[model samples]
Target: MSKPNVLLIGTGGVGTIVAYGIDYAGKSSLSVVVRRDYPKVKDQGWEINSCNYGTIKGWKPAAVYESVSAAGEAGVTYDYVVISTKSLPDIVKPEVLAEPVITPGKTVVVLVQNGFDLGRPFIEKYPENVCLSGVSHIGSHNHNGVISHIQTDKAVISVFENPHLDKDFQVEKAKEFISLYSNDKNDVSYFEDTKWYRYRKLVYNATLNTVCALTGVDTGRLDLSGTLESVSIPAMREVVKIAKADGVELPEDVINTVVHSDDGDWFEPSMRVDVKKGNPIELEVILGNLLRVARELKVDTPVLSLLYELLKAVQFRLKEGQGLITVPEKRPISTKYYS
Candidate 1:
């Protein structure tokens, strides 16, 4: 049997890891869609220093495109389109971003992004297509086009099929995609409850990621400064309550695990790194959408609400400073949320 033709979008730190995993599996033909870094990655390939896979030098996909449009123009329908981009719904709708490459009933779109409800748009757009949601607990970073993965713990990837589509074919497709990440060093598991897993991972991301970004500190510093107990723990508890209100029963010790979990001391979450680098952060999906659900369910989330506001401000400032957006001098602002 021939290998599957896979198109991997978003070549960030996590994207690089996913690409490498697929390449290491050697069971698929991989094509990548990149933005600004397209030229560099296409020219020199990727230099990865991974603790799990060791060092990989000059790794290139089977093909590279600047955008989904270019890939679509190439007239190739991918078997699987794995999106490993940040969940910045405020900037671009997920459906719109994936529009060019998605072949409604033919392609399976797997979302490997952070935050919740990211798969909804794609699911809504292509009910016939298989949609898979994934949560990653991998530690890696990209510096100067070189990815450095810290293997302090086994990289855990939990994936699940969309509950809306209760079909055996969808489940099989999810399993097939999950198998791409199955190696001795990585732990990739398939679960029935994608929402529960998303909220469970949110317990870690909504707290650690938000606090670290706000304080401009690393996870180690946050833990050492007692902020994990005072701030991070409370924030995670709020997430639990919100999750419960949304009808997901998280583990009882989920808060404790998030607060005390050991992924390494100096690990810097994607949000913190994005803020420091003045790039757009995944504020809406991680915290903003969670807060919206809390409000809809009448659940109190003061800690999360505060984090959402602060992070929004930080995102606005960073975007403005980077000249990514223009700020009106005296325009009337609306209180409506991005969602």
Candidate 2:
């Protein structure tokens, strides 16, 4: 199997995990982009903590670029570019991020992040066929440059028609990716139902993440038996309703299936991680999206609206104590959520 040259744009937990997965696959060459002080970031090689790879030794990437422009200028090319940036609005913009991060090689770009709209900007930037939409179930915190893998369920994905894949074997590429994560912990799988998978994930994040963000509780601590029944379960069904209204074909009970099992407890969500790290909350990433969808579909979501309000309220209270606006904490909501 010929290896593909890979360029990863972000160096957060997800980026580190993907780098490990790609290296293990032995079917992809990997490079990860760090910030201005490449020397500083590179000084500390990646320490990945996964059951599959244990507290393994650090592995440096084939190439490291401080910026995409520098990598492009340096004549480094890639067959695929995986974007794992978390904060969408700041990192991804029209002017700063409009340039194609991937070169005109055998490059097929995949966007790995939370939220359905996370890849919307990429889809807008590139032709649909050239882009692949994906979601990772791994959880981690950047514990002093080390990626501590909290939990990993599956790598779920739905392929969009990205123009770049024409030069490559699409199934071959996906299988290569899936094989990389065929460990006991995380399994990568591809589904043809891109829209459904997308919405289904939205259901998972909106329920798991939004509630966690509001309550400031990790999935490990919460008693979700009741949440799975009344709050989370109903909210998930409501999300499906909004999706169907907006023409997203999702399964009947994907939420109940993927989220609430008879497990003892769960893991910390990215939203909660963002809060704990004192980074701006991803309210838009989890809630504002469906709000937009509700507007488009004219769906009513009272429970979601209340959740939004409470999330905003908590964020406001926290930011007030911190003496800053606190990273998009302005809930700025009302009963406007139509489904």
Candidate 3:
């Protein structure tokens, strides 16, 4: 059998780590889709200082495309297109981003993003194509084109097939991508219920990410300051209630599991990091969508709601400060939320 041809989009920390795994597996031919950092990455290559995989220096991809359109112009029908982009639907819809490269019946679109409902657009747009949802538990960061990853424990990836196509074909495709990262340092598991796992992961992100970003602290500091009990735990409990209302039976100890997970105390979540860097955060997918579901189900999420509002303020401040978005001037007596 020939090696699978894969196109990995968004070469950030997660994307770079996944790309390294695929390269290590040697089972797939890898290409990347990058934007502003394209020239730097393509020229300088990738230098990964990893805890689990050791040092990976000067690694270049088989091909690099500036955009999905450029990749499409290459005329290659990829077997798998792995998306590790931030799930910011407000910025760009997932369907539109993947449109240029996805071959409806042939390509498997794997989503390695945070939050819920991220794969909906892709599955809806290409019902014939298999879509896989993956929840990643890896600690990594990218700075000045270099990636530093600290795998405190084995990074776990739980992948499940979306309800769109043949289950068998989807499972087979999911396993093919799983094989690319199932080494001694990484563990990959398959699940039948995608929503359950997505909600489960949200329990961690919805609480820790939100609280950390709001307080401008790291996981360790939050825990040390007793915010884990005063804030994080309550927020996670709200997530549990929301998940239960959504018909997903998360374990009763799910909050405990998330709170006690060995995320290095100093480790900053992607959202907090983005806030610190003045980059757009994945506020909607992580908290906004969950809050919407909570409101629809009439599930009380006062803590989550408050965190959502505060995080949104922080996001607005950062975006405006960075000049990514403009803040409208307000009249002295304006009563509206935005003016």
Which residues of candidate 3, in runs, are more than 4 Å off? 152-161, 181-185, 219-230, 262-267, 328-339
Clashes of each: 0, 12, 1
Model 2: lDDT equals 0.67
lDDT per residue for candidate 1 within 1-339, as digits (tens), equals: 878889988887788888888877787888889886888888998899988888888889889999889988887878999888877888877778888888878888888888876766777788778888876667787777889888522333433455566567777787888787666667777777778878888998899999999999988899889997888888988888988888999988877777667666688877888889888899988888788788889999888888889888898887788787797799978999896
For model 1, where is the 10-residue window of minimal lDDT? Answer: 152-161
lDDT per residue as tens, model 3, 256-279: 788778466587877888888888
Candidate 1: clashing pairs of residues:
none
Q: In model 2, which regions exceed 4 Å deviation? A: 1-3, 36-41, 90-100, 104-106, 150-153, 161-186, 218-231, 247-259, 266-268, 309-339
CA lDDT, every model vs. true structure: 0.81, 0.67, 0.81
Clashing pairs in 3: 220-265
TM-score of each model, paired residue for residue:
0.87, 0.75, 0.86
- Ranked by TM-score, top first: 1, 3, 2
Candidate 3 accuracy as lDDT: 0.81
Candidate 2 residue-wise lDDT, 163-262, digit = tens = 5445246555655556653554457788766667777777767887877776677664555445645676678878989988977867665775756642
TM match of model 3 to true structure:
0.86
Taking all chains together, the TM-score of candidate 1 against the true structure is 0.87
